[model samples]
Target: MAEEEVKLHGAWGSPFSKRVEFALKLKGIHYHYIEEEVLTKNKSPELLKYNPVHKKIPVLLHKGRPIAESQVILEYIDETWKGYPILPQEPYERATARFWARFIDEKCWPSVWSSFSEGKKEEAIENLKLLEKELEGKKFFGGEKIGFVDIVANFIAYWVPLIEEATGKQLLGEEFPALCRWKDEYVSSAVIKEHLPSRDKLVAHFRARFPSN
Candidate 1:
């Protein structure tokens, strides 16, 4: 297979960007990583050009063709690389995976953030319960291996704990034992650990972002 020039434009603190990085690494694909400073108005011209619509971080350029949106990028990577399948082969299972991924990205993320910032912890816990049921007996969302839903829910494994610490509240508890167990496994997995930001760094970042008590 001929190697294509691949590049990813993203920021360090973005879970969405990390999902793409994790996908690429899982597929054993090498690519250049370009860090974009969205806060400082330092988004590169290439990033702006590639993702004019969103003008957001996490733009994957494959042979100079840009793929915007982390979920879309994950699908693209799985399709392009035949090895290390990210989505299941069965149609029903594939649809289920995509559905859960969308649920996490759309509904769960907002609820989780609202709980952290607005003090609506109950709402976040409800959302987490749904995931816990989905993960009932599975080692991962993708059964044995980390898959689409797991990648999309990466925020739960890393960022949510920091949010809990910063808010001085425990949003997740013994009620959701399965989800808690999954989080530990997901964060400590060798591939995921390599891509995750250090716990200290993440704690500091959250503290800086949400300093008020």
Candidate 2:
């Protein structure tokens, strides 16, 4: 079937899914998007069949072969497709980009979540500061163009602010001037503006999780 040629199982609200979408769009690759009910316990059978281990959103099926994990899928897309490259050409630059993406997923995200939920800001603040330093004087983490690191960091640009608004918890503020500026610029772009989850839907999602919100 045409849908199986290049299909993606993802959720609208997931930044992970958006990462794959951005790479495909930028590369001018055509694909079918399958929206899965990721919030519920009963995940779709397709999702389970594909990424049976994690059973998560953002499972990419290209040429009928399944690829799980957002970071792994991103590298696969970059290597498989030509033009509108997601990663850098040079080895050192490419490695640097991967380093930062890993940092975002492993260190930055956990620290930021801790700050949001536990009222512990030091680690998260430091993580943001590190990313801010890396992004200094650049339009994006991937320099002037939106590349791998920027795709990995869509959460900082879109989701965090909505969650903050929903929970009435102020983690990001004037202190993160560069990050704040980056957030504004990133979200203002037509591509990002188009694909990001609606603010209303996200706020409602967060409020549901944090009942007091």
Candidate 3:
């Protein structure tokens, strides 16, 4: 594949943006990463022009063409790069992978975030259990390899623990031993470790945002 200009507009603290960033790095794609001020609502003009509809971060600019949404960007990266495929080859498996990825984005993510922010402990535990079931008996959602679902569920490997620490809540524990082990392995893996933000930084981000959650 020939190299073309690739850029990503994202913010450090956003799991959505981290999804795109991790996808790019996992695919060995080099890109210019632009940090956007999402917290202050001072989003970059380039971000606005690229993603005018949503005006959100994690926009992938390839050869100057913009692709919005982290999930879509992950697909684009996997499709564009032939090597190190993120999705499964079989149609059924690929579909199932996409289903779980969407599940994490649409269902699990909201539940966890709302639970943390609004102090809905039961809701958080219930949703996390659903994810634990999904991950049980498999090395990853893609089965033994890091793939699309793993990338989509990247927040679980890092942010969840950080949030628990910051909020003094126990969303994951002995009850979900497999999920906990997965987090330990995922974050410790060299490739993921290289891209993941520092745990201290993540903890600070959460503490500042939710001091008494």
User: Which of the numbered candidates is closest to the native, going by highest lDDT?
Assistant: 1
lDDT over C-alpha atoms for residue 120 of model 2:
84
lDDT tens digits, residues 1-213, model 2? 255589999998999999998888787778999999888766898899999898898999988899999999999999998988889999999999999999999999898878777778899988998998898888888777889999999899898998898889887788778788888888887777777778899899888877764
Q: Which regions of candidate 2 fall more than 4 Å away from where they truly are?
A: 1-3
- Backbone clash count, each prediction separately: 0, 0, 0
Q: Per-model C-alpha lDDT, please?
A: 0.89, 0.87, 0.86
Model 3 scores a C-alpha lDDT of 0.86
- Relative to the true structure, candidate 3 has a C-alpha RMSD (angstroms) of 1.5
TM-score of each: 0.96, 0.95, 0.95
User: Which candidate comes out best when scored by TM-score?
Assistant: 1
Global Cα RMSD, each model: 1.4, 1.6, 1.5
Show the lowest summed lDDT stretch of 10 residues, model 1: 1-10
Candidate 3 lDDT trough over 10 residues, lowest sum: 1-10
Return the lDDT, model 3, position 8.
87
lDDT of 2 at 31: 91
